[model samples]
Structure formats: C-alpha cells, structure tokens
Target: MPNTRWTIVTGASSGIGAEIARQFSAIGHNLVLVARRREKMEALAAELTAADRGFVEIVELDLAEPDAPAKLHAQVTQMGLGVHTLVNNAGFGLRGEFVDLGLEEQVTMIELNVTALTRLSRLFLPDLIKRGQGGILNVSSLAAFQAGPHMAVYHATKAYVLSLSEALHEEAKPFGVTVTALCPGATESEFGARAGMEGSRLFSRARMDAARVAKIGVEAYRAGHAVSTPGTRNKLVKALGRVLPRSVMRKAAGEMVG
Candidate 1:
C-alpha cells in the first residue's frame, strides 16, 4: 500500500530548487516541477527525462499568485497524482533597508515564503496522513537563526519556515510524516543576482556547490532529520545564534550579511 510517485518541487526552475528536482529524478522518483517560467521547466523536464527515464511533469504557476495553492491541489488531484513528498523551495530575498525596499516586494516574499509554504504543507498533510508515510523538505537558510538588518523581511520569512517545520515534525511523527528544514549556508546560486546582491563583497567567500547542498538536503529529508544545516560553519553559526543574546546575535548577523 505504498503511495509512491510524484513529488512536488516548488521553485524548480532554478538554483537549489532545480538541483533538488534533479536529485529526486536521479533516484527514479516521479516529479512535478512547479515554477513561474514554463519554458525553463519544460527544458528541465526534457533534460531530466533525456538524461534518464524518470517521469517529470512541468507546471508553470506563480506561487505568489492568490489561489495558487488551491489550483495546485486541484491540478495534482485531476492528474491522479498523489504527492508523497513536498519541497517548499520557492522563495526569494530582497536586499536593502526594509523601508526602502518597497512594501510590495516585502509582502510578496511573505506570501510565497511563509504563506504558500504553510498552505501547501497543510493541503498535503491529510493525504500523507491517510497513507501513513510522506516527507516535506522546506528550504530555509542560515539567515533564519537571527534577524537580518538589510534583509529583514526575508530573514523573518525563513525563521517562520524553520519554526513551522520543527513544530510540524514533532506533530507529524506519529502519523509517519517527516518534516525537515534544510538550512543552507552561502551557496553558488543566482539568488544573489535576483536579490540585487550581485558583485557584492559579502558573497565572494560563500562557495558551496548547489548540487552538494541538494544532495545533503535530500538525504537528510529521507533520514527523517528534523533540521539539517548542511555546512559545518552554518551549523556553528546557528548554534551560536541559539545560545547568544538576541541583541548580540542580531547585530553580528546584520554586519555579516550587510
């Protein structure tokens, strides 16, 4: 009675999202790739299927769009695909003073990062619970541990992810559903460029490979780890953030990311 097939990967068009999709496909899991760019997803679907014989379904939908979660649920149901895994990775960071970054962008980040993630996890929970086995991997960041100065809203959204994932992990334990928060440190991705952080001196030193990060996250999710911070440095930083006074860690983190 194993409910096998179709893992939904949000933000699968690029970066960590794309890498996670690729890893799942490599392991012979059927995939449903969701993102705003249809062409990119189609291309990825082609590449993954061509490289191997894995099944890939491309759905181009903006997670930030209202009613997105409902539509996504309907589409999956109509396709007769039962989701056994969910990867909430579709989120972005806006760099700049919170007041100057424009209220719209800040709101959109919350909609996608916190709102969509919550809705999707809730929508899929019943199905997973009935089946008695499933997994959810939420892609958070090292920024979740402390308040960010310039990237205030983005950091706050990730903190929500981390907190929610941990709580859900414990709640879902008896139901046989595992929830994990994959907190990655600075990685080589187009995230900087998208967030207007291109060519910044802060990113010159953060050089983790995207593939490696994806691998670690997938393995951790499979192993049922409640939280997995990939790199040692990131793990240490999170530990310090947990133990240090909020004021002290906040200032240090702001300076580091600033």
Candidate 2:
C-alpha cells in the first residue's frame, strides 16, 4: 500500500507551501501535506482532489516541535508513503531589533527554520538517495545573500538553508538526487503580517505572487537546478548583494526592515 511516489511538503497549509502543493499536484504527484493548520490543509485537499489533480493526504503537525521530524517519518511509514520529494518549507521570520525580540520566540524560529529542516532532511534523504530520482527543494530567501540587521536571526536561518541546500546538491548529485535552494524576495503573503514586516520598506515595492514563485521553484527542482531565485528583480538584488560592501548592505537591510 505504500504510495511510493508521494511528495512530502511541509508548511503546506498556506503561502508558498500551499502554492507548492498545488503545483506538484497539478503535475500528477500525490502529496503528503504537513502543517499545524488542519482545517486549511483539509480544505486544500478537498480542492485538489475535486480537481482530480492527485491524491492528497493531510498531516497536521507542528514542525517546530522537537520530535516532529521523527513523528512525521513514522506517520508516513504507517501510511506506506514513500517520500520521493521532500520540500522543507516550514519556517517563519521575525522583524525587529535582535535585542528587542523575545528570546523564546527567536529560539523557536531557529528550531523550526534550522533544526526542523535539518532533521527532516536527514531523516528522509536516505530513501531519496536509494530511489535515485528524487529531489529536495528548500525554501531559502533573498535575505540569505547578506546580513539582515533588523531581522538578523531570520536572515541567518535562511542563509543556513541556502548553504545546506547547495552543499547537499553537490553531494546528492552522484546519487541522482537533486537538491535545490529557492530564494524569493518580497512576496505577497501572510508572511509579512506574521513577521511584523507589513509596513517595512521591503514590502513597499511590488511583491511577487506566491503561486508564481512556487512554480519557478518546482520547475527548478525538476530541472535539477542547484539554486533558484525567482523574479528578475530578486535575481538582480541577490547578484548585487554579492559585490556590495558589507557595511552598505547591512545599512540598507536595516533601513528596509527597521
């Protein structure tokens, strides 16, 4: 009964994660949607199933919990779902002076953004390697390119994601397992409000649609690309971040999110 072709997408209840699920389903891939929001995931499952895109299995769980990765893997095993693709997209951001943010919240952010992602990857990567035709798409951010002063922890976490993904891309390549890092700039999603960044200058400019970004990411993964930063503007911005002075970059980032 193992659904050996299932794609496991974390944070699949909303935003980029939800869009990614939609795209994957459209391509005939059955999905295991993981998120804390059961109702939302159930709704999405109904829609996807109604469209006859693919089968959808909603798994409501908080990835931020320390044991979530193990629990998730066990659940998948129980369901006989072979995870052919793992999308580590369950993460969040916080905007404010590092010192002003609640220590507990920031730590939880790290737990989800970095710890949970690593745990899940470690848990699922072996199977993907054995399959030799699967992929891992990690959702990093444009912030990964440089230091983000006001959103230091969030930026750092994304940087970790980008670094890990790129390195894994090379290591997994010989096994025919593709790893890709998706870096998106400002996006129109609940992320801005949740992160307290809605009024920031970063969102003052036009933001990319989550659906478009998701499509680009999924396509890049399928193409075996190591990294994909959607949007021409975002690509240019990341390119500039590469050569810009550290001080200048830091100041600009601070101002944009401060």
Candidate 3:
C-alpha cells in the first residue's frame, strides 16, 4: 500500500476532470481517479505515473449507485490511503423541457450529481477536518447563479453544490479545511456532447480550454475560496444574474440552450 496522501478526483477520465487530475499530479499528489471508463483511467494513470507524479490508483465504479460511496470508503481504508482532497466532478446534464425528457434519465442525473456528491463528501470530509487540512472541490456551473429552463435539473444540482460548498466552507474554517465550489462556464469537454449542449448558443461562443478551467479551480481551492467562477465572461454573467429579474434570467437561460 502506498503511504502517500492521495487526492481523489471523480469523473477523471477526460475533460475538466482529467485536467484537474493533471494539475494535482503536477503539484506532487498521488491520485485515485474514479470514473466508469476503466480503459481511459488506466491510460491516464500510466501518463501520470510515467511523469513521476507519484502512485496512481484507478477505481472503475459507477458512483451513481446508492452503495458506491461506502464501497469507495472501504477501499480507501483498506488501502491505508490518507485522502487529502475530494473532487466531485462526475455528473452529466440533460437539455430539454422537463415534461419532454425521460423521467428516468433526469432521476439518474440527480443520483449522480446530487446524491453521490453528498455521500462522498459526507464519507471523507470528517477525516480532512480531523487532520486540519486539505479540502473538497466541487464542480459547479455558471448555471448555478440562475435557473436554466431547458436544463432545469442540471442547474438545480449545481445550485445545490454551490450552496453546500459555501456552507461547508464556513463549518470547516475553524478546522483549517476548505470547501470550494468551482463554477466554470461552457468548456471543451465530452460532457457537452453527452449533454447535447455543444451546439447551443452558450457553447457556440469561444469556450475556455478545459486545462485553463482546471488551473483556475485549483488556484481557488488552494486559496480556500468558497466559490470560484472561472473566466471574465462567466464572472460578468454571474454578476448580472444577481441583479437581473428572475423572469428575465430564466428567459435568457432558456434561450441560450435553444
């Protein structure tokens, strides 16, 4: 068993998740990358190991399962791996009218984006608190600032994440632990394709590189920021949303995805 303290990054096979993993590895952290694709994670593990980023562990499991968090906790404990950070980035978005989308798919999004994240945070957070360091970085979205009509549940999940991370940040401050919500606007990622959002007006504009998004997120997490929204454009959008009428933001958000 590796005695090194590890950073566990979920949804780490590619895109922003993979970029975040690379950033952590470059900074001298061993990693435990969790995702559904074993082959992709293995390839990534090889890359990180060859680069001398310390040991890499790949756990191929669907975290959407209700029991997966317990299994992950047991596995980490069995390996005697001290966790330094948790990155909850494994989630997908669906775009469509609520009534038109498949109910099961929407529910699955909730399971992955909301339930799994909450469970994993609950499972590993106490250890970080007890140790008086490290933190959890949750992947939120600019949509979190306002309602997204076509992607209603997705926006709601991110809003929950941002809220949860901010509250947790306050609770962990005395313990010297941070809880940061990394909110990025549309970036180049497989998630965009999977969510069928790549061609939307929001994504059609110049998108931030996945690497840059991760870099900013890592910096914010290190700085112990409770909320970090990457990109000047995204920051402006969020600021505007704060003052805009909800009905107007709703219309704009809904139109962006159309």
Candidate 4:
C-alpha cells in the first residue's frame, strides 16, 4: 500500500456489496472487501483489477462473530491504510414468523445487521470526522419504513440500521462526513432466495437490478443524502408510515410476503 485512503465494504462477496465495490472502484477509490467467501472476493478483485480503476484487498471475515469489527479495524490500521469510508453492508434476512424461526439464527441476524454495523461505524467514523470528508453507506431497506410480517426480525434490524444511520448523518454532516441509509426495494439478488422471499408476491415480478441499486446508493452517498429509496414510486418513503393507516400498511406487508 502506498499511503492511500480506502473504502471498507463489508459483505462484499456478492449482490449489493459487490456492486457497490465496483461503483466505488470505478470512481477511483481503493477498496477493502470484507466477507466470508474468499473465492468470491478473489473473483471480484480480479474483475476490478482488470478494469485498472483501483486497488482491491480482500479480508475474509464473518462479521456476525463478536470482535470482528475490532479485528478488521485493527488489521486495516496495521496495514497503514487510512479509511475514508466504511460501508456497513454485511447482512442477511430470513422470512418466517419470528416465533417459528430458530432462536440462534434470529440472534445471529441481529448480530450482523445491527451490532456489527454499529461497531464498524463506531470504529471508523472518527477517522472520517477527522478528515472532514468521506462517508458511511449503510444498506438499509424499504422494509425499514414499516413493520414487516413474516420477516419481523429482518425488518426490525433494517429499521434499526435506518434510524441509526440517520442520526449519525445528522451528527456527522457538520463535520463533512455523510452517513447514507440506502433504502432500496426488492432487488435482483440472492437475498430473496436466502430469505425465502423469492416466491413471495413482492418478488414474483421483475425486481430492480443489483447494479442499478448500487449505482443509486453510491450516488446518494457521494451527494451526502441521509436517506435514499431507490426504485420506488415518488420515492417519498417518509410518507408510507403517515399516508397509510398503520393497520392497512401492516396487512399489506403481510399479504406481500405470501
């Protein structure tokens, strides 16, 4: 490393994480791709390398594990790379009634989606604040706008992410650090299959492309937007919880999960 500022993107093996990495790299930002899948990262790194846009480093990690955020921060510090941005995108979702799901798995979802994201943001934010630039692009979801049925835990985690990111943005913006909460609707990714939502009505139709979602997120972060809802009608996400009756929104969310 030749004294470079880097962007750390977690869960960077596939889908939005991978696409976001590409987006940043295209704009000439070196990246540290963190995830459990080394081979996947290697392939992505190869692709980015061939583009000759920016350097790509891979850190294989399970962010759900305790101490992962600390370890990753330490490793990045040891390598002498100053982090410019931290993309807290390492997360997953499961679709099912909360009570019917395995307890440990649900907890793990919380660990990765909420705890890990918070830890990484805490560890890396001071650096951005000190530099008076850079940003944190958190991959929240449109589901954060309302309570989701069948995917209760996942929705709750995303809600937490959205709320936390917005607060951080308000605090960091004065210092010139942007914290963007990207609230994209259903996108073409492994998330649907992994969460068992692929067969659901919400995903039965054509979904937004992962590349498009990533592009929108990167644009939002660069523009210092606090929250972004990609591929939505009017994109007035704040209106969802207010315009619709709480009961009606809840029922509609449940019906979509069918």
lDDT of each: 0.89, 0.93, 0.93, 0.91
Q: List, residue by residue over 200-234, the lDDT tens digit for candidate 3.
A: 99889989999999999999999989999999999
After superposition, the stretches of candidate 3 with alpha carbons farther than 4 Å from their true spots are 1-3
The TM-scores, one per candidate, come to 0.96, 0.98, 0.98, 0.96
Q: Is candidate 3 or candidate 4 better by lDDT?
A: 3
Error (Å) of candidate 4 at residue 17 is 0.6
User: What would the TM-score be for candidate 2 when compared with the true structure?
Assistant: 0.98
C-alpha lDDT of residue 86 in model 1: 93
Query: Taking the tens digit of each residue's C-alpha lDDT, what string does model 1 give over 1-258?
Result: 432577999999989999999888877788999999998899989998898646888888889987998899899999999788999999999888988989998999999999999999999888987888877999999889889898899999999999999999999889999999999978888788888766545576766888999999999999999999998878888899878999999888777667
Clashing pairs in 2: none
- Report, for all candidates in order, the number of backbone clashes: 0, 0, 0, 0
Displacement of residue 85 (Cα, Å) in model 1 is: 0.3
| CA RMSD, predictions in order | 1.7, 1.4, 1.4, 1.6
lDDT of 4 by residue, 1-258 (tens): 443768999999999999999998988889999999999999999999898877888999999999999999999989988788899999999999988999999999999999999999998999889999898999999889888999999989999999999999999999989999999888898899999998898899668899999999999899989998887652654477789897888788888885
- Any residue pairs clashing in model 3, and if so which? none
- After superposition, candidate 1 runs with Cα above 4 Å error: 1-3
> Comparing candidate 1 with candidate 4, which one achieves the higher lDDT?
4
Q: On a 0 to 100 scale, what is the lDDT of residue 10 in model 2? A: 95
